[model samples]
Target: MAGLLDIAPLTEKVRVGGATVEVSGVSAGGIVAMIARFPEFRMLMTGKDVDVASLVSMGGDAVAAIIAAGVGFPGDEAQEAAAARLPLEAQADILAAIIKVTLPNGIGPFLEKLTALLAVKGGAEALAKVRATKSH
Candidate 1:
């Protein structure tokens, strides 16, 4: 069989809702979530309007490519090597963990809490001070 195909181009940052979303460093499921935005990828997922088994076969290749590309991760050679050794299933599990932590019920609760916090006495002032310090 041929070696893994290069999928570095797919790792480029994507724009969603007027904000840049990084797919780099995300798990296999996360990469699927990102790349599945493409109509072709979506088709691959559901085997809808396409050859299901053939498309599913591409799944491993795509995930492997994304991991190998090291999308958003810091340049850590050891981590990369370790990740490379992981079976595809383990990689997917790690990605799932990342997605769970990073995307727990969207921003609704977070924004609500943030709004409440900023409303508290000295909250806005404290944030302002931090921002001002960072700007210097």
Candidate 2:
């Protein structure tokens, strides 16, 4: 109960059968990001410029890519190799675009799978529109 990880802060607000139910939704959705697959940007990114600034100003793909990388999620060589295939500059922007598209209020899902998914999704101009809509 007392150690490096604790769910108390997360659960204190809601309950399952009681007030717990309220927190349950938040907990599952929230912790999924934590327990779900995520990777380190340091590992994922080369730290160069690839259109992230323009993308993040819109605040959507920035959120999406961060999600898709699955910082917490450990993937295989194929996964890392797959991520590496992204153009150095476009990596983060790719995620930003995904987050921009699907997210209504939050970016967790977007951040969770932004990059990897985009590589599969494929498209530059289309991605831009997704992220830009957040501002409008």
Index of the highest-TM-score prediction: 1
lDDT value for candidate 1? 0.44
Note the residue pairs that clash in candidate 1: 24-72, 27-95
Question: Which whole-number lDDT from 0 to 100 does residue 126 have in model 2?
Answer: 48
Local lDDT at 116 for model 1: 71
lDDT per residue as tens, model 2, 16-99: 122211111122343344224332222222222323463344343223434333332223345445545555444453444433
lDDT of 2 at 4: 55
TM-scores of the models, in the order given: 0.28, 0.26
Top model by lDDT, which number? 1
lDDT of 2 at 122: 76
lDDT of each: 0.44, 0.37
